[model samples]
Target: MAVKGHGMEVKDHGMEVKGHGMEVKGHDMEVKGHGLEEKGHGLEEKGHGMAVKGHGMAVKGHGMEVKGHGMEVKGHGMEVKGHDMEVKGHGLEAKGHGMAVNGHDMEVKGHGMEVKGNGMAVKGHDMEVKGHGMEVNGHGMEVKGHDMEVKGHDMVVKGHGMAIQCHGMEVKGHGMEIKGHGMKVKGHDMEVKGHDMKVKGHGMKVKGHDMELKGQWYGGKRSWYGGTMSWYGGKRSRYGGIVFLNW
Candidate 1:
């Protein structure tokens, strides 16, 4: 004998098995009771409480609440939140455990964010903290026609583990600025400045219209004021090139 009731409450009388396929196989049963509250021993099963065997599809509410374990199989796109979230097989995979927020803009305002892989790449704007910043494994930050400022200890810009090479302008240390083509400096308390600067094998070279050094000038040839020619601190005749004097 089969008895079914809609919008009914059967309480305290003892054993209650709600749904079809209880005593008989190949039969469909559905219990749609709205706002039904079961307090003690809410749901239990001897084997597999909710099992969908042989190509069956089970979908819960739009905002379903599962208190315990949740599993998905052979699905294209599956999303899970809270605690253990696992995925098997590779090919365009995004898996996160211990609070993973996946969106267009994911903002994490907590502690510790880790990315474990051989090489991690970032295609957008990557900004670091004020005091500490780093790049590893033959990869450094590359900015095209933009300014980068690092205000901390030991600023190193190296190519093949050697300072700087092939640059328009390269500055180092405190108060020393460089601004032209082909320059190099490797000494304590050194200053090198140029226009259209390049720091290479040689040294400092100012390849521009005007070049000045410590109130002295060099355009065509080397000469001092009052018709005096000094080469390597040796005086000679300085009546050929133009010399400017400050009175």
Candidate 2:
């Protein structure tokens, strides 16, 4: 562990610095290795925990934890089994509400976390986190929340959804969603499924790349780099190609 100005940086080999609690400025902090376990920086004050095991690792803090690879908390109290998970704040006891996972890689959990649906599962890139606004994922990653942002050559974003999975593609807020092909966008109750792709929300913005008309359906009308926009159900859409935008 290399001690920087204040924030203790942990590079490579995480096991070496296990259990060494450092101070993040004033916020007590502690980090563990890949397959190790460590208590929170504030312990009971926050009760954050991190438990990891063979490809299945988790970082728990502020009531959030990331349990890896099919872990079973075989206790007489809270019996919850999970793999690659990050759960935090929001009074934990009340789970099973809206759980959103990114990629094939992670989960987030914690307090003040707004869960949607009685049984909602979001697929991300091997990253997960819950409560108090938490996220876990990297590279070609996708995050679903009230506000998400991504910038780069390859990127796709929807209403509160930020997805980056390609090259030369950059997408901004809800006003736009770019999927290669000169900014291929999908709007209307935005939902990215198998074949059909929908991008819907209050606002959107996209740029970068250009190509043939693919698919699009929205409520606005505009032309960026020769892209067209359509409208329906009193909503507006400014698309450049074919998109699946249906209620």
Candidate 3:
């Protein structure tokens, strides 16, 4: 069936067009202009109760549902079930999930979940993340009531008996703390006050010596004069950097 614009084209058992080239083919239907296209076994749009089968379903605005096989959605009460699922904003809900997402009231249930923003709630295994006031329970606990930002590098903090209170955070590696808020590390070693952190490999010492040390061989003993040491490589050890002395 072939129908073109500006009204009136008709064929029984399929092919009905009225204004702006709307086309319908017996079992394989197509409608143009305002953009509505339908094929056999499932397709519905605009009124928002969208349906599609054997995968590939799309819905825009309010209460969306897609069953089985890779589902993708955009805005307003988004829902996805089983197999490579992707979702976008507003009261987001995912079941037996897969993920690639954008923000707003997030909720995810089981199976390789990926992340985005806003009032987060995640339950059950495999979580990958983005931002916004977090609360994660059931074996992969990330409970941040105010703020959380994780920039990756195999960062792991697992909890069952939780106690994490930070005014600020940035961990480069090993044994972390920022009481009175201040820490920055580039090697090992830690201690801070006021706020500043920078380190570049081995032999670290701080006693009110407002920091700044660069690579290779620093055999400690500089109290408050812009620190220095030389010969860059491994083994001549003792870095343990980041002990802020009011800078």
Which runs of model 1 end up more than 4 angstroms from their true locations? 1-130, 135-139, 142-166, 170-175, 182-188, 193-247
Two-way lDDT contest, 2 vs 3, winner: 3
Q: What's the lDDT for candidate 2?
A: 0.24
Report the number of the highest-lDDT candidate: 3
The predicted structure with the larger lDDT, 1 or 3, is: 3
Output the TM-score of candidate 1: 0.15
Query: Against the hidden true structure, what lDDT does model 1 obtain?
Result: 0.20
lDDT of 2 at 246: 21
Assess the local accuracy of residue 161 in candidate 2 as a C-alpha lDDT between 0 and 100: 38
lDDT of 1 by residue, 1-247 (tens): 0012210111111011232111101111111121111112121122212211111111121111121122121222222323222222211112232211232111221111111111111111221111112211111222111112221211223221112223322234311232233233332112344432211321222223111122121112332222243211223422223332110
Q: How well does candidate 2 score on lDDT at residue 129? A: 27
Report how far off residue 57 is in candidate 2 (Å).
24
Which 10 residues in a row give candidate 3 its minimum summed lDDT? 112-121
Query: For residues 1-247, what per-residue lDDT tens digits would candidate 2 score against the true structure?
Result: 1111211122121111112221111111222322223233122111233332322233322111222212111111111222112233211221121112322211311211111111011122222222212222342111233323333333333343334444322234332332432222334223332222233442222211101112232113432122244421222222113652321
Two-way TM-score contest, 1 vs 2, winner: 2
